[model samples]
Target: MMGHGPVGVEALPRRVSVPAAPGSCADSLLERDRFEWRLGDPGDPATLIEQFLSTHDLPVTDLARPGDPRRHGDGPCGAALFVSAAAGAVLVDAPPGAPSPAAGVPDVAVIVYGHGPRHHPSAPPGPDGWWRGPWQPSWTAQQHAAAVDAARTAIARGDIYQVNVVGHAAAPYRGDPLPVLARLGGLPGARYGGTLAGAGWAIGCASPETLVELVDGRLVTRPIKGTRPATPAGRAELLASTKERAEHIMIVDLERNDLARVARTGSVRVDDLYAVRRWCDLWQAESTVSASPADGLGLADLLRAVCPGGSVTGAPKLSALRHIAALEPVGRGAAMGALGWVGPGRLDLGLTIRTAAADGDRLHVWAGGGITWGSDPAAEVAEARAKAAPLRTLLR
Candidate 1:
């Protein structure tokens, strides 16, 4: 019913394009015997999603939740799907009646899956770019102060533990993203780029956090919730932060509970707890939870039960999300979304944090951290800044 092949950029064949709109594709095309994939159709995305889920035997949990306008919509340009197995990555971009590439051609094709890549057309300087002046919150300091105050109040009321509040500052660029995409494309152990439902093209530089990975029927989810900067002193202080430990534990418990909904009795448990991970620029506190789903549990069901990841949303996820909706000025887009791959009898997904999005000339990046009861407004803001620093460097 479905298949994949590797199709590189240079080797792609010029084939007649499909005539479907951005969000609407004929059921007949989808039912074709050959492999068919798409980004967003011009019609109802939900219908298309439902059809894909059913056709692929994708679980309801794996499906992105509805109503998050950012996750499901007509993407900035067009819609396409890239598949890779033995050949490379096969891309099918159907930007409203645009000709589809030759079918069955293989190697790799251009399909930006996350928002980080599509948000900006060109790359900005890293530390020495246009020196777009010193970076500061786009919003006034007063607005940030208010958000901190709101977060403190929410923490006091037990409505949330740590709310990762974020701010944005504009970064202008005039370079093509192709070079960066090429560097990142198909990097081993790294699931590179793709377009998102709400966000445009993005790059996933995620390491250590396994949103969802299946191995021999075992489903694993590792969520990193606590952080300390990577410097020696920062690492020492971070390891000593009681608040960070508490936050990590809470999310782990929540994840365990989420897995239980679909897992067999006594099959859900924490495989690792409070493990420290040292990435290139920072240190993170993480925990791993594993579960074996019941006979009928599939990818979609597992995702729906646990999505809007607990680490990003905080404990008592729905309430925290509601509070977040009220407090956050702008939509998160793909900042806190999940990315990865889904295929026959297997899936791998990750939370889309520490990510950036580009669309044409505009570039958007976000950073936030948890706000527990012990959180200090000033300290929380500093943490968010630190988290956003590396991504800022890459964007520059």
Candidate 2:
């Protein structure tokens, strides 16, 4: 592991690697060199991202053909992007060379890890680990439950079918958050887990849901909804609940529509439906949807189509977004966005759920679930805590 300097001071040297645990998805992408740029265009990050990648000779995958093996974790990452829920994105090139910063602080940093023998200087002792401080929630359980009821009311009024009510929690930390981040990213069932850091802010991701991925000319997304504890009874309850199934189906339909916009005619299909998956100690329902890309589709076009994923939003994505803006206490920040590697003719990005950010002074975390008319307000509050507990536990 490399030592971290004072936040926002020194630039990260070229390559970065996270030592992968046994059977871990957080593999190493030994980058040759890197360059960092911050795109302020929140409304149109796709265009900026596409342009940046093109200018830097990194790009969208168009050459992938049918039957090409999935290369998500095996190859050198061309670039990695961190898109924030606030409508902005950060791009990092993954070729070779020292990091060349653009201008302001980056929202999230990019680090690619690879295998083989290597050594790095250890971080200083004082700023090395996190303190077990009292974490604070942006919304109390009552407040979060009230938001859930509000969503249910909206559903009753026919304003929206379902809305994801998010809650935020934060705590001050005295040390570098890298170790906590690494441990969070290495947790079991983290299909999309890793640490990406910038000057002032950093994200430790342990997302199990796939926001979007493209390989062999096919675009794929796995929207996860409906959660329960990860136990025999929890799995049974999750699979049996009609309400959970309904929530899962709604997001599946929404995802299908999102992909249909850029899919080849009549090529979209649901590969799986409501499969229960384990993420640490939780059981969540996930469904797979895929489509062949339309001819000449680009990365910018794809992101514009399915970004701010429906599972995190709600049915009728735009309206749900409007409600979310009005109800949430704080901005979603790095959570509920997209994070992962982007390579030419191949891309793999995960939905930033179960993700946390550290901004020099404080560490931030967000968690929530889809709210439907049948949702129980109290249960919803507990669900959010259940989702956040793992990350919080790892932080200590």
lDDT of 1 by residue, 1-396 (tens): 011122223322212112111222211111111223333324333233335545533343432221122232322222233221111101111111111121122112223211112121333223222222244455565676677789779888877776656565545444433233233222222332333211123232333356666656677888888777678886787678887888888989888987888778999878888877775567788888998877666443554565667777666766666666566665554355555544333356656566554434445566777777777777677777777666566555
Best by lDDT: 2
Compared with the true structure, what per-residue lDDT tens digits does model 2 show for residues 120-184?
54442344455646788888899999999999999999999999988888887776676677677
The TM-scores, one per candidate, come to 0.66, 0.83
Model 2 residue 43 lDDT score: 33
C-alpha root-mean-square deviation, candidate 1? 12.6
lDDT of each: 0.50, 0.71
lDDT of 1 at 301: 56
List candidate 2 stretches off by more than 4 Å: 1-3, 6-43, 61-77, 88-129
Q: For every candidate structure, what is the RMSD over all alpha carbons to the true structure, in angstroms?
A: 12.6, 6.6
TM-score, model 1 to reference? 0.66
